[model samples]
Target: MSETYWDRHGIYGVMAEFEDPEQLVEAAKRTYAAGYRQMDAYSPMPIDGLAEAIGFTRNWVSLVVLIGGLTGCIGGFGLLYWIAEIAYPHNVGGRPFNSWPMWIPITFECTVLLAALSAVIGMLAMNKLPMPYHPVFNVPSFAERASVDRFFLCIEASDPKFDLEHTKAFLKELNPEEVAEVEK
Candidate 1:
């Protein structure tokens, strides 16, 4: 809840442009190794090792889906049990009230349904969707070439190790095509 560097300076970050995905990956790996955690890389297509280079680990969405699935499974089975044993208490063909075997289909469907919904919602929340604007788009070269042929690495101002001049010099050492400051 404290004031961030961006809040104080109106600067988003410093960005470096790379022409090749390999260069981007290498630069990202070096950056991450240099102890920079608040950084991101951009590329036109999926690069094989970029995620690993950026130090991306486990995500929380899977946990969310797992919990949602368990909730649905338990809730579905409980609903059926309540209907059969307590709510209606109906008997058919002299069968027992707790006919659990017949609940498998409904329970499975509910599990799948809730898991799928959780996946969608979790992904949206995790990715911060509905974002119509970002400071990265403010860079002309990035806006023109990010989805075309260029790759980018941006180290945000909010990073603990971020010092404007020092970070720029560090990025320069990576031999990027161009390095620019991103304004908020």
Candidate 2:
């Protein structure tokens, strides 16, 4: 196969749909046991134990926020320090050139502004947002019942252990109402 063929066909994984949330959770556990890593679960509402069943871990949003806040704090202080001490130093009303108190408001504002911007950008980048299309959206039934009553589990094509036959059989064993092979 050509590189493009592999790029298009290599990421073959099964999408299993379930009627009951509990069954979906159980199926997720079984899928995890079968060594599928690039899998996701969808539900009409949050289901307990689903995260553990699918081995989903907490995201790194907090770390991103912390780094952003720290950077903002440092940058704010540095900018104010440079302006007050080096750039156009002035002794207004006999106050010192390095006026720490006067710089507090600007420093605070800059810190908040940069931190908020970083948080918004970081979240978008981390989640891979702004995607124009997805293969899951191509599944006909997927659009009909995704938000109403059905639950879905999809194993992406990028997973290292993904095999068409094995994945189909694994999904079948989970007793899903329907198992569909998605193409991108």
Q: How accurate is candidate 2 locally (lDDT)?
A: 0.81
TM-score of 1: 0.90
Could you give candidate 1's per-residue lDDT for residues 42-147 as a string of tens digits? Answer: 9999899887888888778889999989988998999999999999999899999999999999999999999889999989988899799999999999999999
Best by TM-score: 1
CA lDDT scores, all candidates in order: 0.93, 0.81
Q: Show the lowest summed lDDT stretch of 10 residues, model 2.
A: 1-10
Residue pairs that clash (backbone atoms under 3 angstroms), model 1: none
Please list the residue runs of candidate 1 whose C-alpha ends up more than 4 Å from where it truly belongs after superposition: 4-6
Global Cα RMSD, each model: 1.8, 3.2
Model 1 residue 151 CA deviation (Å) reads 1.6
Candidate 2 versus truth, CA RMSD in Å, comes to 3.2
